[model samples]
Target: MVKVVQPAYGRVFQDDEGAAELAKVLWKETVAALKEAEAVTLANLARADRYVRAKVEFENLYPTAYQQGPVLKGEEGGEYFNYRWSACEKLNERMLKLEKAMFGEATVKAGREKPAAGKVAADEFLGPDNGIRQ
Candidate 1:
């Protein structure tokens, strides 16, 4: 298991237990996604560290958005703010880039492997001489 560095913004959470729980969940999710990409290499894990930090920061900043509304209002002329939807979008873009780096491409390229010389095509076996109709 690779250890990810804590995000500087995570300090806002304050509760050690809550922070630990959040970290655990993030770590597991990241590991699972990396595994699915067949990219559980050390280099990929290191790349994942950045994604984890962004995710943790996002979670810390918008903790109540799921339960409440996406937008959160500030009190009495203080600094008004909304949910971190832009941050979430940025996180998604980063995830896509990471997956592409790890997994090559979303679609497999054609002719990546060529047939050996003198190999018969499978269609040949279904020809008339083999007693199979097209």
Candidate 2:
């Protein structure tokens, strides 16, 4: 189940509008949460990319025993960094696919006319897979 975070402005809201107002509040909260998650995921991908590039450079320049195989136990630099690099790469791939689904070019029928690059129509997401109005 998805969870929505408390809105930063929630304290200013009143309870007079009852259920309808509450529903709107919840929807707003959900949108904010989604935006926050997107930002964090993007930032994480950037950090992971930097770490992987640096790891490759370090290995090339030093060519230490830990860099090759059977990294030394309790080592904090090479082995640990490599593990982090692998985990982050996996996460980055998943997030990028999701990002593509959200903001990048969505798949259309091969024979259909394609929209201008970066031009997503309003009704594009109004399908069974996505709840956005297509």
Which candidate number would show the highest lDDT if scored against the true structure? 1
Compose the digit string of candidate 2's lDDT tens values, residues 1-134: 33333333233334333433453444454355446656334443443333333333333334343354333345444433445445445545654554454345556768978888755675466555445454
Show where candidate 1 strays beyond 4 Å: 1-16, 62-83, 108-134
Clashes of 1: 0
Per-model C-alpha lDDT, please?
A: 0.63, 0.44
Best-performing candidate as measured by TM-score = 1
Each prediction's RMSD over C-alphas, in Å, is 8.1, 20.8
lDDT of 1 by residue, 13-102 (tens): 456657656765776787788777667877877666666666666666555544455456676655544446556667667867865776
Model 2 spans > 4 angstroms off:
1-81, 106-134
Error of 2 at 83 (Å): 1.6
Worst 10 residues of 1 by lDDT: 4-13
- Which stretch of 10 consecutive residues in model 2 shows the poorest summed lDDT? 4-13
TM-score for each of the candidates: 0.45, 0.23
- Per-prediction tally of clashes: 0, 2
